[model samples]
Each structure stands twice: as C-alpha cells, then as structure tokens.
Target: MSSFGAIMVSFPGAAHRQFGKQIYTTLIPFGVMERFLMVDDDVQRKLNKRRVKSIANYILMGIKDGNLCFLSAITATCRGPIQYNEATNQLSIDISTQMSVNDGQHRFAGVKMALDTMRRKVDTSQGQQRLEYSEKLKKLEDMAIPVVIFGNLTKVMEQQLFHDLNLLANKPTKSVSLKFDNSDLYNAMAKELKNENEWLIRFGIETERTSLSERNRELMVLSTLRNMISFIISGTDKDSNAVLTLENYNTWKTDVSELIDKLFSVLPEDCNDRSRYIIGLAATIQGIGKYINYLINKENLSDEKLSGLKKVDWKHTNPHWNGAGGTFDPVKERIVFGGTGGGVNGIYMKLIEINGPSI
Candidate 1:
C-alpha cells in the first residue's frame, strides 16, 4: 500500500480539542502531497486559466534558492488517518483514502502545473544546463506547503467549509489594491499625484473600488488615473520596458509629474461636464492619454508644442466626431465610448485628427 509521511504537530486552538477532538497539522512537499489533494468537483469553484497562469508566473519569479515565497495553508477535510505515532509525532496518510480540498484549489493547481513545467524543462536540457534545471525542479518539488488536515468531517461540514472559504471572505477591489500597492511604479506615481495636486483631492478622487457617484466629481477613479499615467509614460498600458528603471526613477518621476500638471492645467474648469466635453468620460481620458504618449514618443513634442491640445474641440457635439461609427449620441447628450477594440481605435483616431497635420 502506498503512503505519505508527515511530521504532525498538534493543531492550534482550544476549540479543536473542546469536543474531544484531536487535530494535527503538517507541511508536505509538493511532489509527494500533490497526489492526495484532489479537487472536489461539486464543492470547488470553477478554475480560471488567467488566474492560474498569473499565480504560476508569480511562483516562478518569486521563488529562488535559499529564499521562498509564502503561501497560506491549504485547508482540507481528510478521512481518518491510517496510523499515527504519539511518541514521534509522525503520521502516515493512506493513498487509498479520500481527501477533499476545502480551499486553495487554484493555488494547488498552479503549484502542480509549475512543478510539472520545471520538470519538463529539466528533462529537455543537456549537460550542465540539465543539472541546473534539475536542481531548480528539485527545489520546487521539495517546497513545503502547509496543509491543515481536519479529520472525520461529514459531507455537509466539508460543503459548509467550502462555502465559508469562498463566499464569506471579502475580496479587495482592484482600485484599493492599486492604491495600496507601493511596489508598482504607476501606483506610487498615482499616490504622489494625489498628494501633490490639491484640485484632485478636493474633487474626491476615489481611491477605493467604488466609482464617482456625484456628477460634480471632476476626476476619475484612482486606478483610472494610474492607468492614464502608465500609458503616458510607457506609450502602451502594459509595456513593462517603458517604465522607469530604479536607476532613473527621480528623473522619470519629475518628467511625468511636470507633464501631468501641464495637461491638467489646460483642461476646462468643468472637467466633469460629459454632456459638453469628451474629456469628462473615462474612456476619452484614456484615449487622450494614449495619444499624448504617441506625441511624446513618436513626434518628440515639447510641452510648448503640447499646448495645441487646448485648442482642440473636445465637445461630443462637435461635428469632427461625426463618422460611420460615431462615439457621441446627440439625443442622449452623452459620449458612448464602446469597450471594443474598434471603439477604442475610433477614439484614438479622432484624437489624432483633432491634433492636425503637425501632430
């Protein structure tokens, strides 16, 4: 019979022992533990490919020799153990028995896939390279993932645990995460901009997940501003290479801050008047940011040359926006910035048109 070995410590919390219950916890290696941790089809959430890939990338990037990334313990309900020794605090988990993962199924999947990928890479390498890859694969396989084994749980209890783990926890919104993420250059810049600009703070720029509710609010969401800054600096929203390296942070920061200040100063006093101007719309702002990036990178336009943006007719009612796939709806008195790629391209082209032959 196949078995997995673990050094079990008495589970924490008095509540675990109150009902004449004894619980044990163990940190198991990925290679050995992956077999037993089964994803229950009925209880588990549907797997998201994007999320799994992102997690796997994080693990690959973060984990190194003599350094390890921390992942929260995986909670699971186990069938009764095959055997345990009171003296040694060692436990044997039978491979034949059933175990259902109550939480961290995505994490489990990501780790397993990452290990497999490493193994495949190792297998394909040759000579010294093979040895290096093998070492990394071994390290990943031996990575200890803490697992809390709750024994003698009924089906109902398992279901309840699953529900509690997935549903009860409050997940932070993207805006909140971006606002608090000091590590990201764009996020840090957004925070700095908020602090530097009294007008933005006064307009009640939302740092949280919630959107601007009042019509009078001049600024968009904090995350939106972060994206705008990212586009302005990088020329593209997701271009990592365009970002300022640590060596030139101060220089880049000064440049970006100055550009942002100039851009904001020229905008109309009623920036939130979406009915009259496209500048009030979030999509329009993003489009204009991208266009500004193009002018900086492609045209090499100075701040003085950029002053021409103030002359453009930004109103949605302007005939310049009237085309086959127009963004403005005169009847509703609003600009309909569509979410599709075509819609975005249309807005970008319209901005380019307004900038004229010199742009």
Candidate 2:
C-alpha cells in the first residue's frame, strides 16, 4: 500500500502530533498527505503570525517526530507566498483568498511557523535541519506575496527561509515563471518524458498486485503530452522568435504527430489507442520544444519543407463517429484562429475551439 493520503477536518490545531506521525508513516506508504480544512474567524486572523505558523509547526512536528512526513505536492493544487507587515514583525498573506479558505489559510500560516521553529532551533553541529529564511524582503517596496500552494510550497518554504535568515533571494513571483526559450522547451519536453517514464516504471514495480500501474502510466504520458503542447502554443506571439511564424505552422503540426508517435511507443501496449490518437493532435498544437534550433541550424530551409505541412492527412479513427456512419476529420478540415479554412496550416490548433481535457 502506498502511504499517501489527505484529509480535511473542522479543527485546525487538533491531533497535530498524531496526524504528523500518520502523515510520515501511514500516508507516505500510501503516497498520501492528509489535508486538513479548519474554519477560523476574524479573531484567528488577527493573532500573531507566529501563532498561525505554530499550527503548521505542530502538525509538521508530529510528522518529523514520527519520521513519516516528507513535504511534497505531486497530487494537490496548492500555492504559497509570504506577506510581511513592515510595522509589526508579522507577515500577512498577500493574497487573502487563501486565508479565506479555511484549509489554505492555516496551511500557509502553519508552513511559515514550521520553518521559523526549525530555523531557531538549529545548532551548527546538529545540522540535520537547514535554515530557509533570508533578509531580502526588507529591501522590496511591494510587501505582497503571490499565492502558492502544494508543490509550490517547496519554493515558498525556501523563500520564507531566505527571508527568515535575513538573506536576499529571488522574488516569489519570479520563481513561478514558465517562459521557455525555444531550445529550453525541447529540453523540458525530453526531461518531462523521462520523468513520466520513471513514474511509469515505478508504478509498474510498486503496484504489481494490481493493473493500476499501466493506467497510471498511460495517464501520466498523456498528461505530459497535453502539457507540452499547451506550453508550445502559450504566449507564442510574445515569446516566440521569428521562426514560429504562421508560414511554418504546418510543418510544426506534422512534427507534433511524430512527437506523439514517439511518446506512444514509449508506453506499454495496455494503453488505450483512442487516447493515443487524441494526444497526437494535441501535441502538434501545444508542445514546448526546441525545433526552432534545428530551423536556425538549417539556414537553407525553404518553402519546400513547409508546403504540405498545413494539411492534416490523418484519417479520423474515432470508433464512435464511425459507428454512427459519420466521417468527420479531426484534423485541419475545419477553420481555426483567424483563418477561414484548414486553419492556415495547423494554426487552427491554437484557436480556442479545439477543446479537450488536455487544456
């Protein structure tokens, strides 16, 4: 059994020690982290930030004691940021919505306190724990913090530590930037695939008793493809170089199919073919990659390479549509973007209507 789980509760400060132990021991085995949602009133909000952080400290303290907790956010939607009160030695939330949400508010406040507690207790020789706060925030004019949660906590924790230690660090807002250079995108895509494969292999080895491994592996691959495609299309106008122009979009479309084929071949045959097909179309539109590097390398690249690129030649493989005696091409048969037909090569993929769960 994997030791990961999450739970919600009405009480914010209860069962902290035991809860922490369970998180480290039981939940870790199950690959779970229990998330507690507690309701606090305005009075609780006004308390010293340390008091708020104590709740997190107490829970994490339990996890530390039990040796069961390792902070991670692979399965949750969470954000973290630090808000500072210049006048008081307090840090308030920059985004108060998290504070409004019962669970999020406490989680944020508790995380800060946990770091503070750990930092103050540090002995140079005992260095089992590291101090994370720094003094950089004192120089900034804007004291507000961006909202962070779950996986993002890793960064937030570091940022808070930088602040606590009176060290200057990168702003929390800057750390979350997803801008990709053309080459960086390809490296990211490759790394993403490698990570997915590792997850697949682990799931296979760890869940031998059940067939859940194959399903999980497929889902991860599919998700990576979806994310990669979106990353490519996102902010193309602002961040893209001259290479990603509409003239070459068609070839990019074909490359997307090739990329999907490569991704699918890496998966176990147990995966559904329908997912494979949809993923191919999605990848052409949203992949984050460095094909532009190749274009730059090939200075002689001419119109011949891009001529047939805009065409979506794939036959529709949807069993449901075929069963109904309908033949609708899932490709550039429809208009997209500002183009009236075939979406001016694969530019249609960028059109808002090409909807799928991947988005």
Candidate 3:
C-alpha cells in the first residue's frame, strides 16, 4: 500500500562486510514508508507512552523551529534477501516483505506521531494559521530519515546487532559531561577550580565520572562542585543570566576561587573524613555552600566575618545537629542525613545557629 517510487533513493554504504565490501541501500521518507516498517509480535520491549510523548514533543518542537536533524541513522533488517540491481546501482525493497527495525523504533514512532498531529492541526486551522500549518506539514512530509537497511540477516544476526547497538553503547557519566561543558558558567568554574586548587587535587576530586569507586579517595563529584560554585558565586544553585557575559563570568570565577580557597584553609583536619564530618558528603557540601551564600547576602558578612565560620564545630558529633529532625547512628558513627531537602535545611539552620547573629 506504500508508495516508494517518489521517496526511495539509492544510498551507498548501508551494509559493510567486516573484511571490507560495500553493499547498497534505499533511503526513504517516513511519511511514505513508516507504515511498511514492522516490528515482530514476539519483541518484548513494549512502547512506553511516557517516552513516546517526550520524544514526540521534542520532534514537534524541532519541526516547528526547522532545526530537527538526526546525527545517527536508524537501522532495519529484512527477514529475507533484498533484490539488488547491480548494473543500475539500485536496491529493490518489497513492501510486502517483513522489515524489522533493529534500532530507533521509538524515535521513528514519535516522529510519525508528531507528523500526524501536525497534519491534523493544519486541517483545522484557518487563513494565515492554516498557511503556516500547511508549510510545517509539507516540511515534515519531505523530512529525510536516514536508515541503514540490512538484507539477508538471520534472526541471530538481527538480535546481535540490536544488542551491540543498544546494550554495548557507552555513554559518558554526569561528572565527565559537566567537566567538559563550556556553556554553563558553574561547570566551567568547577573545572577551573579542579585544575588550580591543590587541596582539591590532594583530596581527590572525581572529574571523569559521577560514582566513586570503592577504593577511590575522591571527595567530591564534578557536579557537586558545579552546584557549590554556582551557590558561592550567585547565592543560588542556578546559572544567573546577569553573570552570563564573559566579564561577569571571569569576575565571579575569581571571587568563587578565592572564597573556596579561604574556606578550605580553615576546615578542620578531619574535614575529608566522611565518617567524622559531613563536609565530605556532596549534599552537605551543597548545603554548606548555600549557607555561605546566605551569610554573604542576608547577613551582609564581610570576608573576615565569613572566615569566622572556621570557629563553628562541623563534626557529626556536634550537639547542634541532634534532634529537630536530625538522627545519628552511634554504631555507624555517621549522622543519618535526612532526604535532600530536609537534610540541606537542617544543615543550613545548624550552621546559621552556630555562626550566631552576623558576627
């Protein structure tokens, strides 16, 4: 039932042998060929509505803005060998043949759904709105979906390809992603601090990944450092549009580095001992960083007054943390930190109480 004559185009390098041989493929428009793409009834992965809706929204936004581009191609394998005309350099695909999408089925479905939605909108609009929606619908129809078609692939080969593509794919962790992020001023500042601070390097900051190894001595994740730096510079855990400029970023970066250096210099000798002090914990560090911001902003504390934070006892054994939603386990010798919001607030209130009335 699908019309492939207008949409099909000869695409080279769709299939490559391990030893080095090139096979041909056909690139088709989703608008024309999506109905022909089939999934076997035995496939265990059911379509998730949440995922489909999310991806469909993303696709809709991209199509509206005219910036949707897929960097990776989708792949599908034929149940039987495809007819190829070597003399004409064309691959003949039969619409009746069972074509199993090996990967990107979700994306394909989302895009199809998004296109259908746009078509419906176009049908209901009037005048200028109708014209605009019509344009969008046309663009969606013409959108090229790159597909790598594999022919004569056995069931085992199809399963292996799917496993290799999805299961074996390596994605960078949050810390590594944040470390290399240049757009966010907080991430940039954290990376700079990691490079410049001898204390951070000595304490072993985790830059390459989020999770700490069992034997790893890293005291902070890069994402944690990012939040800390953001709070220290802007009195908030969010990037401020006011400090987005290069001049403001540099100034804030310098101030943050200086404040962090001073803060670390006065920390107790056991600051890095996770069992003794919450300072080593990421959530606790974020809470402390926020409290510091509060002191600098709300309490109008000078650098000298801020430095007086060293006088406060930050150990887990400090009675200031007892009761009032705070719990400590004597057996583990560690404060049982509450959930993120409650724990941060608890730490903040405790610090505020100890610091005592702005001097």
Which candidate comes out best when scored by TM-score? 1
Of the two candidates 2 and 3, the one with more favorable lDDT, higher being better, is 3
Predicted candidate 2 versus true structure: per-residue lDDT over 1-359, tens digit per residue? 11222222111111112212211101111111223222335312344565665455444434422222223221112233322333443432222223222123444455545544544545332333332222211211112223222222344443443344334533332112222212234333433443455433442212112112213333333323324443444423223343443456556545544544443444335433233432223223232122221222332323433222223222235332222212344573321123212221242332212222122
Candidate 1, pairs of clashing residues: none
Ranking of all candidate structures by their lDDT, best first: 3, 1, 2
Model 1 has an lDDT value of 0.69
- What would the per-residue lDDT of candidate 3 be over residues 1-359, giving only the tens digit for each residue? 12444333333333445423233456667577565577653432577777777677666766644343352577777664465555666665665566788887787778778888998999888999999999888877777677777776767777777888788998889887776666555777788888887777778688787755434567788988888876665656764444444558777777777777778888886577776676776767877787878877888857787788788776778777765235777886667666655676677777777777675
Better of 1 and 2 by lDDT: 1
The superposed Cα distance between candidate 3 and the true structure at residue 345, in angstroms, equals: 3.7
lDDT of 1 by residue, 1-359 (tens): 22345433232221143245455577778886666778887777788978887667657754654323567888877775635555566655666566688898888888988887888889889999999889888878877788877787777877887998789999898888777676566777778877776556655467885455436565777877777777677866665574655566678678777876777677777766665776655666666677778788778768766787778777777777655135657687655755623444566677677776454
User: lDDT per prediction?
Assistant: 0.69, 0.31, 0.70
TM-score comparison, 1 vs 2, better candidate:
1
Candidate 3 is scored at a TM of 0.62
